[model samples]
Target: MEGKLRLAKKNLNISLKQKPASFQTSSPELTEMLGMKLAKWIKKHRVGCVVFLGPFGSGKTTMIRGVIKGLTGLNNITSPSFTIVNQYAKGKMNVYHFDFYRIKNATELESFGFSEYIDSGLLLIEWPEVAMEKIPPKSLKVTMEFLGLKRRKITIGFI
Candidate 1:
């Protein structure tokens, strides 16, 4: 059943309803700008969750910093590596940033009541592979890949 669900998800063209977008960034500044653009889309759509897929130093955090700054106008964005999750408030909306890099399994996520946050606020998860099964099916997925030097290719779509 899970395999079928995965296959069906892969075949679904979410872009048909809402076009997917991609961006290339050669510096942290550009990456953050791209993230800010995505933030606007998320707010317009009232997106509840976003999953970020990328290796370390691929500028995932940098992009998230842009999103937070754009939405909340707070410049103190940082990775939640040690804390696991960080929450920020923007008016009535709350942004929950989660890093699953150190998580070993889904059970670890459940131990901290992860689902509650997903149900309540805008969620941005980094290294989502560690808890793929827990991610909401409707969540947007962003993939970042290193091209060369400081350049990164970011693809945004729904799955």
Candidate 2:
């Protein structure tokens, strides 16, 4: 485990070592490590809004699910593509998953109290380009890219 973590850390681009925490990952197990780190952040900071940007088939959804699985008691995590949004409860907090792929306009999210969700629940938005103008400026961004079959490079850009 230590060796894998060291390799993962070595492969990452340290943009802000001065900041509390940051990481970049290039393999599936390494990606899971990054998710664990973010899980710790969520536990410590209570983050509500997060945006994930990446090309198709880059495993963004997979990483998010891994994070949710690692989260204690967050058992109902699922892709929200069909319903547009899926809410999962973890103890007293709520995690809202949003998929904007089918959304023709940003206004479509407004009717569902998008601002209110951003204000209150932990939101994981996929295909966030459509509502990029509306998302909070401080939201954490995770971008993923295809490295090869069953391989991915995930970079976390925190704001």
Candidate 3:
């Protein structure tokens, strides 16, 4: 069982390296539009996890709000900074949004039933550096960087 599992994991990793998709958004509307496109891709691909990396005020939360709107048609969304996690339901699909900025260690993740959330629904993680080692191998990684006051360069790839 272990050998088969390892093989399957290896194959999945190899498959993810096919190509990466990237885009640049100069305004909040453009960022949200990109998020909506990502939402469609996520649903079509049945993506399980996504890790968001960006500096503070880089619009990570805004992108997430767009994703929620695309997935569940929910317009109101907020960052889970203090709360750590937020769960949303849209018919049969469940989205589990997590913020690890406050986490001190991997043990903290385990303490809060992080593993359970991974298997329960689609995961969108912000500030994943706190527990980078614990993130699943198949997760999609999104990196955002500010170009100017409102422009952002967003890159999406598997890592």
State each candidate's clash count: 0, 0, 0
User: What ranges in model 1 sit over 4 Å off?
Assistant: 1-19
- Candidate 1 local lDDT, 1-159, one digit each (tens): 432333223322334377766666677877787777777778877778889998999988999998888788888998999999999997987899999898888788888778777678889999888777778777899899999988788888986
List the global CA lDDT of all models.
0.81, 0.68, 0.79
- lDDT by residue for model 2 (4-110), tens: 66645552232433342334445666666566556666656566677887877676766677667666556556778888888777687667788888887767767
Estimate candidate 3's RMSD in Å.
10.2
lDDT tens digits, residue span 95-136, model 3:
988999998888888898787776788889999897677787
Superposed model 3: Cα runs more than 4 Å off: 1-17
Model 3: lDDT to the true structure: 0.79
Q: What TM-score would every model get versus the actual structure?
A: 0.87, 0.78, 0.86
Best by lDDT: 1
- As for candidate 1, its clashing pairs are none
Positional deviation of residue 92's Cα in model 2 after best superposition, in angstroms? 1.9
Candidate 2 achieves a global lDDT of: 0.68
Clashing pairs in 3: none
